[model samples]
Target: DQQVKQNSPSLSVQEGRISILNCDYTNSMFDYFLWYKKYPAEGPTFLISISSIKDKNEDGRFTVFLNKSAKHLSLHIVPSQPGDSAVYFCAATNRYNNNDMRFGAGTRLTVKP
Candidate 1:
């Protein structure tokens, strides 16, 4: 059941550089998208989100972009900090089926000072 997929298993970046995370989904029914960041041995924390109606959303240094036609989405973190290093998961939920959320395997991001 590969509804959502993050092809890159991990990413390495400089502390002040931009970190880009990619995600793809097979199910077009997905309307809501979210990005979650998790530290080792801890639960995922919500980082950012975008709706199908909007192609982009931004908060602070985090931005989420969605391409409905390609079933693709990406997260951009500017001036990435050491604290931003974590496992990031892409999640999706259909508006009609809000109770069920599908999540990607997750991509571990490491920032080097």
Candidate 2:
């Protein structure tokens, strides 16, 4: 089932600017959220995460915000760099259930110089 969705297929941003990525989920059972960055020919790497207990989580220039009521989430990259350009995947999972993570169609981010 396509419980997670990334409406934007791609985003372009200038270097040193902020990039916003949005995601939505239909399942209310998801309590854990994660964002992964994937480079060409490489596996997706963990970027940032947020749990249902918190509305926001930040790690350095990367931040993730969760709106439980709206069943939505977003990832913000501050001062985005050219190296940050990649395909970003939004994922959701229920901690109580087996780790059956659901991933949205990745959104390709291009940070231009």
Candidate 3:
């Protein structure tokens, strides 16, 4: 059973446009959420994060929104750039299981220049 789900396997966007990625989770116990970006043959790098206590968190061009009631979360990249093209993964971990992070399958984002 998948705890986290990224329904869209891939997403395409024109450069300078907004790219929104969606993620859903089945476990409500999760208290922390994070977004990671990975390039070919590289490990995932932390991009942005949000605590379950907060509904939204932003860092420059990236923003993460969480909907606890719906058990869903989303990452938004405004004015998408070609450099943003990568595999994005959503991860969540609860206080009880701080060491165990549940990760989504990952969404491949392609920014067309």
What TM-score, computed on C-alpha atoms, does each candidate reach? 0.98, 0.97, 0.98
Q: Assess candidate 1 and give its lDDT.
A: 0.96
Candidate 2: which stretches are off by over 4 Å? none
Question: How many residue pairs of model 3 clash at the backbone?
Answer: 0
Instruction: Give the candidates in order of TM-score, highest first.
Output: 3, 1, 2
Error of 3 at 19 (Å): 0.2
Residues 55-89, model 3: lDDT tens digits: 99999999999999999999999989999999999
Kindly provide the TM-score of model 2 when superposed on the true structure, using C-alpha atoms: 0.97
lDDT (tens digit, per residue) of candidate 2 on 12-112: 99999999999999999899999999999999999998989999999999999999999999999998999999999999997678579999999999999
For candidate 1, write residues 1-113 as lDDT tens digits: 89999999999999999999999999979999999999999989999999999999999999999999999999999989999999999999987888889999999999999
Q: How does candidate 2 score on lDDT? A: 0.95
Q: For model 3, what is the error of residue 78's alpha carbon versus the real structure, in angstroms, after optimal superposition?
A: 0.6
Query: Cα deviation in Å at residue 89, candidate 1?
Result: 0.2
lDDT of every predicted structure (CA atoms): 0.96, 0.95, 0.97
